[model samples]
Target: MSNTKLVINYHITEKCNYDCQFCFAKWENPNEIHAKRGLSEQLIDQLASYYIGSGLQSTKVRLNFAGGEPLMLGKRFIEIVSYAKQQGFELSLITNGHYLTTQFIEQHSHYFSIIGISYDSQDLNTQRKIGRIDRKNNQLTPTELARRIKLIRHISPNTEIKVNTVVNALNWQENFTPLLDVITPKKWKVLKVLPVKNDLLTISNQQFEHFVMAHQSIAAMSAEDNDSMTQSYLMINPQGLFYQNQIHGSDYLYSPPIIEHGVEHCLSQIEFDLNKFANRYIKTINNSHFLTTNTNIEVNHV
Candidate 1:
């Protein structure tokens, strides 16, 4: 009944390759059993089944690969993407761009319509120095990271390659300009860092202030550079997490909380009257912020 299509963010791997202090995932390796461990094929199959059964066949869907680092579950992810394409759906991935390899990209190029790679120069040294706890032996560097982005562009030039960065205290002012210099030619995207509890991505209040200022500055300059493009965008964390959005009155879809209910349930349940998705966004924001603020207040009082 709704003309709006759903962009489903499939959180395949909660395990990341880098232990960046700013990472919000808090992706500690529990190393649990099959169901409890990393993203399992079972979860993928369940998601695929849910999509098919929901009669949301008319829904133009894009399966966004979210992660600790999606490539950590490389082969499995490729298989899922392949399955989705076979069933007539679009697939995309968001990565840290560290584990990228020529062979892997070549193999999976047909699977994904787009690939988003994240990099933050402020956390550059940290990523270089340490390995993600899940992948303890692996470490990534800026040059290597840059090389991956270039290679993705070169190999899969047709594939939409987006460099995604979280603008916060460290890079917002001092280093962002240089980062823009490198990425803007590639037409990369810079996103605002949304607040998350116990998130490594959390910057101080001062850093956040600079981030907004830098964002406004970039928006003004970008208007002159390309009026056709909207550089900043919002993404829903798969658990249906709320992040910041400039368009308060717009629809921002999220997965229904009940995994068994599927997409049709979500569509039917959402009351998109005059306010559209604004109602849902406000509700989520209020709940999440309340919890976050109370937790912080409790911590401070203690």
Candidate 2:
């Protein structure tokens, strides 16, 4: 790991308000660690002690709070990130933007280095078809999303904004240039839908390429296909265990709970390719120059 930051994507909860058909946050256990406050804090403490306290001055740990929807945790989510920040870890959050209310951004935006919102389509019908809407038929329209981004910029100017778009059959042909221009995010990640749960929404590599080509003019854009996605991320599930997607199928290979077996022991049970991770990290840094501000950290898995 060439002085790259360790991005531990902790899927704190499997519960989400939206019913996105392509969502891959599913795990075996419905009981997520977030429900158990003490256990959740314990996991955070262990991660901080091992990664931040390991005396590796060359690596910076970015604890990205992901979820079925992290913002749904509301005040509890704020407390978790606050604790992680105190432990010397850089914080980021990937939310669906449904619960990314003005109150939260105005009050807690300072807690994050980056805030990623999943915005797949600008068309309300497309969004509804993709299950990106809540039970009440509520969705984050482009106007609303742009409004939120403006608020973030005004309140937390230093905090980088990110937009995550999953390229699936439903929205691959749609042009996002107008939307991207309006939001003006620091980074716009276009990810090919993975077939972890089902291939119903998966698009061909060629189709995915078309979407990327159409938006090639976007300066802050990056695209990731399935091949580049697998075995590259350091993921921890809601059960407090290190896990990776199986190379061959939809199945996942999990380690013993990190809280119980220790980080080293748990990591040993999974196959994490350092080379792949380095490539992804380097690409991310290249795409977003703002990440270079803090680069003196040691190598640790996220």
Best by TM-score: 2
Off by over 4 Å in 2: 283-302
lDDT of 2 at 218: 84
- Summarize candidate 2's per-residue lDDT along 63-135 as a digit string, tens digits: 9999989888877878888888988889999999998888998999989999999999999999999999998
Candidate 1 global CA lDDT score: 0.49
Compute the lDDT for candidate 2: 0.84
Q: Indicate the worst ten consecutive residues by lDDT in candidate 1.
A: 222-231
Q: Check candidate 1 and list the clashing pairs.
A: 22-200, 22-201
lDDT of each: 0.49, 0.84
Winner by lDDT = 2
Q: What is the number of residue pairs that collide in model 1? A: 2
How far is 205's C-alpha from truth in model 2 (Å)?
Answer: 0.9
Per-prediction TM-score, please?
0.61, 0.92
